[model samples]
Structures are given as structure tokens and as C-alpha cells.
Target: MSISPGPSNLYILARTMSDGHRSGVAAAGGMAIGSLIYVLLTALGLAAIFRYSPTAYTVLKLCGAAYLIFLGIQTIRASGAGNTSKPKVRIMGMSKVFKQSIVVELTNPKTALFFLAFLPQFVDPQLGQVALQLVILGLLYAILAFSSDLLVVLLSHNLGKWLSSHPLFIRWQDRVAGAILIGLGSYIAWQEFIQK
Candidate 1:
């Protein structure tokens, strides 16, 4: 479930494809690094804070939604002025992508909650150091997630290349991506506020 092509992952892949395979790979790397941090934080008991504090979770969720909105607005603005033949002049660097992805992952409280609820079922207290065991499992999960996301990046990059050839698609690609982000952000807000 963790490795699934969620909204944030798809957004990162699409954004990175603007810069080619290298960017896609970097985006995947960033995502993996972010997930790794979440896993470690969950192992270290950050999940407890999320679980117990609804307000904290809500705050994080809103921050994530806001960030998505920001990204969406940026994409929409770029689409109007973007060129299809070459990479966008505003193409993000690996470090910027890394930082953005990490923040996005961190603000997603559900990832931490998922880790909290899921990783412990396999634990055996008899083996000793529970924290160590959790850490190992979390690292293993991170590896699996990275493997899956890398595959996604490769596929998305190819698809992006195909899309780039079509003049209409090239013109609309960023706009579509931006709209998706905005919709996802709205969905998150609805899930957090209306559903509850």
C-alpha cells in the first residue's frame, strides 16, 4: 500500500520528467529518502504524537494541502509560458525536488499513521530490542518502496516523452498536472474536514 502510485508520487514523477530521466531518477531518490525518514521517525515514536493529537494531524494535513496548492499554482503558471522542445527554464534541481518531496511526505500524517499501525504486527518481543526490530522492518519497507517508485519514475518519464511530442498535450500537460494537484489537495481537505 505504501508503494502505490499515490497523488504525491505521481506529481513528483510528472514534475521530474520535464528534466528527463536524470530528473525522474532524482525525484525517485528524493521520494525514497523522504519515505526512509518517515519510517525512521515512526520507529522512533513520532507516530504516537500523530495518533494522540488530532489537532497536530489536522495541522499537518492542512500544510500538505497548502503545499500541493502552491505546486499546482506554479505548474499552471508555467504551462502558459512553457516550451515543449526543450526542458522548462524553471526546471527544478535534484536538491529542490528532494526538499519538496521530503516536506510533502512529512506533512502527510497518514504515512506515519500507516507505519505505526502496520509495522508492529511482525514484531517479536522475544527477539529483544523492539526499537531495533522496528527500525529494521522500516528500512526494509523503505527499500521496497524505493524499488517500486523507481519503476514508476521510469515509466512516467517514457510516457512524458510521448506526451511531449503532441503539441496539444505539451501545451496542456502542465495544466493537467496542476489541476490534478489542486484536485488532490481539495480531496485531502475534504477527507480531513468533511468526512470527519
Candidate 2:
């Protein structure tokens, strides 16, 4: 019989998920709620902001871009300053992370469009209640995500110090993370400007 991946797997995944650097535990924790919120909201037909208007989509993409770029810049600044001991204020903390995740999930028009097209495919109303089915699936996803974050906390507890101390890793992490954010922002902006 095959065994399902458990705590150990999560630990390892979290540890290695990002070049030996880990996302904040609080961020991950908030992401759990964020995931559930998005799923639930999307299911409730509240995620339709993405599909309707070009202007709204553009605005959301810009917002997402700005957030990511700012984070990337902060990462670079932290690495340049060689201060990696404590969690940075912007990315850490339960409340901030929760709010940030929620905004990121909600503000992106793409997410709304995603929910609009995604839910009905597998939802079988004949078998049972639709809302219950959504809750079940969404809960499963949230549990998995929460577990992943816990793993991040445990595995990176020590490794983060080692990785952060290395000059190359810090600079590289910052640059790559930054570039990704900028790219996302540019892409979204481009799509909005050119496509419409």
C-alpha cells in the first residue's frame, strides 16, 4: 500500500520551497485563511470582478504588481543591509499577513474570473448540496496549506540563519524575488494596456 505524505514531507517542502529561505510563518498562516476566504467568496459568486471590465482588471493587476514589487525591493534592501535575524515587519505578523493575503487574493480580478469559470466544472448538484461540496473541497485545500506553512516554520528554523548569512544567497534571493514581482506587474499591465 502506498502511504500519504505526512508531517516530514511538509517539513522538507517548507524548508526547501524557496532556495533554503522560508516565507514568514504568519504569512503562511494567514495564507491559510486567505485561501479559504478566496475559495468561499468565489464560490458565493462574489469573485466576478475579474471577468467583466477591462479597467477593473487593469487596476487589480497594477495593485498586485505594486505589492509584489515593493516586497521585492524590501527583500533587496534587507539583503544589502545584511540584516536577516528577525522577521521584516512588512512580511511578517499575523494581522498584517492576514490583511495582505486577503487583499492580494481579493484585489486580483484574475482570481474572480478564475472562480467564475472553475467551480461549476466538477460541482454535481444532483448528488448533494453544492455549497457543502464546495466547503468540503475548500477545507481540504486549506488544511493542506496550513500544514505546508507549519512545515516552513519547523524546517527553516535553523536553515534560514545559514542561508541568510551568505552574501550570495541574500542578494540572489532578493534579486530573483524582485524580478519575479516586477515581471508579474509588467505582464499584467501590458495585458491590460495592449489587449484592451
- The prediction achieving the highest lDDT against the true structure is 1
Relative to the true structure, candidate 2 has a C-alpha RMSD (angstroms) of 6.7
Model 2 Cα lDDT, one tens digit per residue, 27-111:
4555566667767875675545545665665676677666655654654554455355544333334465446555554544444
Global lDDT of each candidate: 0.74, 0.53
Candidate 2 — which residues are off by over 4 angstroms?
1-23, 47-58, 77-80, 83-94, 108-114, 148-159, 171-176, 191-195
Cα lDDT for residue 62, candidate 1: 86
What's the TM-score of each model vs. the native? 0.89, 0.62
User: For residues 41-99, could you state the per-residue lDDT of candidate 1 as single tens digits?
Assistant: 77778778877887877888888888887878877886766565765564577777777
